[model samples]
Target: MYNALQSYTSYPFAHLVFGEGGDRKTLNFDHRINILQIQGLKVPNQKKKPQDYSEIEALSKALLTPITAYTDQFSRMDNSLFKIIGWDEAWAPLSSDIGEATMDSGIREGRSRNTSFALASQNPTDIKGELMNNIGNKFIFNLDDPVQIDRALEILKLEKNEKNRENMTLLGNGECFFRDIYGRVGRLQFDPLFQELMNVFSTTPPSEEDTEAIHQAIQAHTEVMV
Candidate 1:
């Protein structure tokens, strides 16, 4: 996403990424990246501590404030500004009642206000009920798990059948079963125009030692907090 927009000197739309840190390396398309931790909106390069109930509310409000502010400023469709607010590593936010409420309000009210929400999650089951209704487009990527495939189909509003199941699993890397806002369904492959984007979007893991070192660091931090 960042690579696609990097060429524009002046962005046509505003983009804000909401995540629990760790995107600093990959999200460097522009100098506007602000790593604001939920508490006091600190700009530090550290892994965030796990949130309890009170902290969850803080994080939820922090995310919802901008949406509310932007929506309130929209007097007319012509005068409204376009913005895309994305939530990466959305597990905790999706689980929170207040977070879900924030998203619910944003998804419902954002259309007229020219605000769009992008949520990235590995598990499709997390998207349920009213949240599922508001999602106009779905990109069903490769899934090795039957449970995830089932949920993906459910999100696609496709019938539970053998053919659909096979088709979903058949999707390779950068390929997806796309269902658009108009309910049109088709298969699509993501071909990056520039080779640099491959590096920007790659999920390839680091060496085992590097992984272990990072894990140990987080564990030590958690112990200190405890």
Candidate 2:
């Protein structure tokens, strides 16, 4: 997901606003992508981040502004001003008061503004009921857990046949069952080159910190020589 977002930044007019729990410090900060780091929303006197709903509310308002503006000014246009808003681990905000309102509105009305949302979550049940119902596309990965598999099957409205359930459990890495809004379903294997690129760009916190330190050291050395 991180690598994919990084690649997207290369496109013109593409704006990325990542939410909390994203690796803002590493990937986003290093790449200079705009991030909404919840940790930065500190309370005036308190030592911890803001506990009230205000922060998220502000974020929700900010997110809707562009869509609203685009809708008003360019509703007749065929293309969207902002192409995509990728929501990683979307369940967290989707369950919130502001998140529910923003997501609902975006899903229903964002198309006029030429915007679409891409949501990702570990469990289908974690998504809001309405949002889950309205999702046009779905990708089902391997799930060994009976409870999760049952939930996925229910969401997909798949017949509870033994063969279908077994197939869900046996999906290999980089393999997924793809379903489109029109009810088309098929198995897809991602390209090997794409998977290799993702693996190469994947980074953890410790590695990010070390990389940043090295970067700063190189900058300092270059400055001294200059």
Candidate 3:
């Protein structure tokens, strides 16, 4: 079926018509949502609650913070990405090693350029789990199937591209919301980055000075017990 939005100036309201797709031989599968006025039920004279500005502002702030933070984090993925399956666009999923070679052949900055193989979605968790599992250790909640992984990637890829960026959106993939309450920004590679920094601190190379700086930053950020 199809959905149609029609507007009429004088009527002061829009009409929503839902129906089956246009066919050469059939038109019987259509229905209009606002046909109630035709049935004499428009404006039943019920008083509605007035608008609440304070509540709206608070909710708006809460919602905007996370969404903006997440998009910003996605923008940084190319810097240290290893295995991202279903998160955002701007990166394409290739089917074979030929494609991996194609990407790595260019010396682009994305760290995930030459991954072994793009995991599929079936029982597999979304790109978040993919990244953690592929790069980190075991997880109790992480799913482990290629079809589920692919299915999730497809849903997220579609949701991300089709929706409005400035407004809130509802997203789902069989189950799971890619964009959630907590901001997705973090030292995602904290352990790995920390290890690398440690290794550099130990290694006698040109990067030893930079490694000392990273060690100081870690110490500065670490919490001290009172």
Candidate 4:
């Protein structure tokens, strides 16, 4: 039986909302405190020497990007994106001449915050070592086996409310079928949060949007029924 809804404190469920990391500081140290202010911005300070307040202000004004080091001729914008603001004025004159950068520039992936959230919560027991390749690994469950099916059901049961016995029974078998057959080979990987999201999503009355999200989530995560 498939449950229409379940408690979201555990796996596949927790994995979805917080992702799989159980980690909170996904963003860099400086930006983490002020994430909203620095997604697509950049500011370059003076040389290594922090002679005075201007350098501190420059450091504060610019933002961190995917690439750490920036060249001489660089800019964030008049209010522009870090990469698109001032290309020729900075990069060419400097890069073409001394082959050294006077100004360096780049942009951080804005969605990094979203990515971190997707992997913030995870099941350490469900997680295996040596396969840290990614949180979302793919494996199909083979539910034909009764024992394994029970295990998967147990996971669902533990996470569901007491009132939803009917739904639990409904999807329990199918959950088993999926885990044993397709999911046994390896851990579902991508972002661990995908599983958690699906665990929550699966119980929300399978609609067109939800079903698609479930399928995608399932495809993206490594599955372990317990």
- For each candidate, what is the lDDT? 0.64, 0.62, 0.31, 0.31
TM-score of 2: 0.57
Cα lDDT tens digits for candidate 1, 1-226? 7654353213212234333356454333233332323322211112433353353344444554564344333322342466666666555456654456667777887787576777777888877767878987888788878999988888887998989999988898899988899988889999999987986677887789978998999999999999
Error of 2 at 15 (Å): 19
Total clashes, candidate 4? 59
Residue-level error in angstroms, candidate 1, position 153: 1.0
- RMSD for each model, in Å, please? 13.7, 11.4, 24.4, 24.4
lDDT of model 1, residue 224: 100
Candidate 1 matches the true fold with a TM-score of 0.60
Q: Which stretches of candidate 2 lie over 4 Å from their true place?
A: 1-82, 192-196, 200-226
Model 3 agreement with the true structure over 1-226: per-residue lDDT tens digits = 1221222212322221222446533212122111111111122111222253344332333333333343234434444444332222212212122222333322232343432222332233423433432322221122334454344444333232323221112222122334222323111112344666666545356488877998887887784531
Q: Whole-model lDDT for model 1 versus the true structure?
A: 0.64
State which candidate has the highest TM-score: 1
**How does model 4 score by TM-score?**
0.15
The CA lDDT at 116 in model 3 is 27
Give Cα distance to truth, residue 77, candidate 1, Å.
Answer: 12
Q: Please give, for residues 89-178, the per-residue lDDT of candidate 4 as tens digits.
A: 222122121212222112122122122111111122232222212323222233334444444444332333433333334443224212
Model 2 per-residue lDDT tens digits across residues 116-179: 7677778777775677777788888888777788888877778777888999988987798888
Off by over 4 Å in 4: 1-112, 116-142, 158-226
